[model samples]
Target: MSKPVVLTIAGSDSGGGAGIQADLKTFNSTGSFGTSVITCLTAQNPDGVTGILEVDAGFLEKQMRAVFSYFPVKAVKTGMLFSESLIRTVSRILKEYRAKGQDFHLVVDPVMVATSGAKLLQDEAISSLIQELLPMAGIVTPNLDEAKILGSGEIQTSQEMKPEAISLSKKLGVPVLLKGGHLKHSAEALDILSFPNGESLSYSKPFVQDFNPHGTGCTYSSAIASYLGQGESISSAVGKARDFLHSAIVQSFPAGKSKTLNHNPD
Candidate 1:
């Protein structure tokens, strides 16, 4: 039997706790073979991101094409595509793959703001993302801040989060996973998954008291995609993935001066 193949299209985290590094770690931990197409390079640590250098759109496309041309990718997850050009290029590739009847499961983590409140995506790129790529995504995972950015308002409570998830799913024409990690809460981290068919699932797990969790959002979405590549239903995959992320956070390591590194069982 061959291992399921999962590809991550995201940025390079030199800190080794987030972006492409974290995605690959989550994929491997979930029993999938991982591949990556880096969109940007960042100088960052647990404290914050110091700098960002985006890869040229042409080179980024080349990397994606190279992987798809040779590897049998079962699923693909995207994070931190910094520019409108990169988003459009990725949209084109997705269209090409679909036209060829290769409909790989796609998980899009709309990484607009960093953990330390730095704006990761360009202001002009948000509209392009919604117009081009959101509709093509199988699942869109947005943290509270990203959701607010997308919705143009604050989503601070679970009641406000539910309808917004459904509305975003309808607006984007895909399932929406509204992550509740950024909410000010004490009980548990609650995430809502809403589909276009009016079906919704809510997942909650005890929030680990680890302030050093750096790549948690990236890890969670990629873990879900890895499970989907292994033929699990979306709801079940998300539930299991949530459990996996909790474990990873619980066993997280202090990697840099301030942040903790996600554990990869690979």
Candidate 2:
């Protein structure tokens, strides 16, 4: 069977739990062929990130060219682009592809902080991400802190997420999936998907406790991209992805003192 090709532009996680590793796993699980463009490399484990090495912008561009030129990339998801130069390079090259009428769905996971509290995206790159990269996205998935940084007021509850998601969607001129996983006080994990046109949908599941996996964000966004690659609508993609992630978390097992998602849970 010929599967749809989904591309992930993200960092490499040596732990094999997040970033490019997670994205590829999710893509494969959700029935897509996965391709990658490495933006950075991280020496990290579930406990914390030890160090990072940013890929040169030229090499990043070359990777993008190699993938896009050869594969019929139906969708792309981006994670941890560490610098302003990298963000700009990605924006420029993707824009060039779009200019040539090569349409593909883009899922932007606005990854700022890693699960272990390491800063993935640099502060200076944030403005570039907002101005250049986000506008090209089909959807932007941001956790609570990321939403707050993306110009939302304090979001401490699921109810508070609605208005913030709406506002951010309008501000970014794209669909926003404001993730409520950080609201540890809540019994249910809630995520609000709001569109620029004022419509919204809620995706809620019982919060999985003691299951902090390293790659959940990377896996979730890539699952959405995989579904989009399979021609699902945005709302359907988000819903299905949310369910996919929930299942992965529920079936997770330990990996060297920290838990990692069971990407192939059957």
Candidate 3:
């Protein structure tokens, strides 16, 4: 049987633990063929990012067109679009593809901040992402901090997550998957998936201790895209992705003073 093709449009992690690397690994692990359009290149490791070189907007459009022109891309995920121009470029291309009657699930991983506390998305680009890119997504995955920025105000606990997710989903006209991994006080890592219809799904896993989840957000969103590409409903995709990510976290291994998710965990 042929595997569904899923595309990841994101930066390249020189460390190989996040961004395009993690996304591609998760896509294959979840039974999909992975393709990529690198938006930028990051010089970094599991420790921290030193520099970033963004791809030009025109070249980004070229890459998108090249991929969609041939492959039957079933799903596409975006991460770390560092600038306003790139965000608008991506949104326009996606809208054009949809206008041409092409069908594909778009998963938006609103990666604003890196695990190492490096700013991945520019502050000036936040508005462009919220306005131009987010509405085109089938689901937008945001961590606690990103959620707080996109939504109304501060999110202190998991209790505050649900309503904010619901509100964000309604506001964006897309499903919102609010990741609570940042809520360290909780015994369980809780994630909420809120639909515009006022429905919500919760996924909880025993939180791993002393572990740095370097590529988790990228992996989770890509896994969802892979599942969605395989024809699963959005809710089912989130559930499956959660389970996959939880397993990867539990089966993590040591790498350069930190741990990396075992993307191909057996």
Candidate 4:
């Protein structure tokens, strides 16, 4: 029995908490063969990012093509595409696959910010991502702050998240998962999902102290993509992803003066 193939096109995290590292772990945990195309290299850790080196656009495209050329990729997840050019390059590759009649189950984590309060996506890149990359995605996952930026308003309460998520999903022509992780006062973390079909779903988990949740977003989104790679429905995938992420938080341990999640917890 061959494992299903899935790909993660994102930055490399030297810290191994997020980016390509987290994606690969989630993919394999869901029983898929994980492949990757690195977009940038970030010197990151539990504390913060120190430096970043982006891959050349041409080389980035080449790496993507190399994977698509060989693997029967059932799902592709994108994260931390730092520049407009990089986003464009990734979008073009997806378009090529689409043109070839190869449907891609794209999971786009609109990763604009890092847990350490560092900006991961460029201001210029947001427009290109909105116009080119997001439409191709089967789903887009954004935290409250990111949703506010993408949706153009404040989503301060659970009530606010629904309309914004529905609005964004309608605008993007795909489902949207709006994470309420930033709602600091909530006893439990909540997330809302709005599908293009006008249907909505909600999930909640005991809120993990967000202080040093190094890869929470990455892990959650990667889990969704991984489950999708195994042919799970979007809602089911989201549920499992939430549950897995909650467990990761439970198993989290201290590292480097801060705490980091157990991406592949036993």
Q: Which of the numbered candidates is closest to the native, going by highest TM-score?
A: 2
Can you give the lDDT of residue 186 in candidate 2?
Answer: 95
Per-residue lDDT of model 2, residues 76-156, tens digit only: 999999999999999999999989888899999999999889999899989999999999999999998898889889987
Candidate 3's error at 216, in angstroms? 0.5
Scored against the true structure, residue 198 in model 4 reaches a CA lDDT of: 75
Per-model TM-score, in order, reads 0.95, 0.98, 0.98, 0.96
lDDT of 4 at 142: 93
Say which prediction, candidate 2 or candidate 3, comes out ahead on lDDT.
2
Compared with the true structure, model 1 gives a TM-score of 0.95
lDDT of each: 0.86, 0.93, 0.92, 0.86
What are the candidates' C-alpha RMSDs? 1.6, 0.8, 0.9, 1.4
- lDDT by residue (217-265, candidate 4, tens digit) is 8888888988888889999999989988888888888777767777766
List the lowest-lDDT window of 10 residues for candidate 3.
Answer: 148-157
Question: lDDT of model 2 at residue 62?
Answer: 97
The weakest ten consecutive residues by lDDT in model 2 span 207-216
* Model 1 alpha-carbon miss at residue 117, Å: 1.4
Better-scoring candidate (TM-score), 1 or 3: 3
Output the number of the lDDT-best candidate. 2
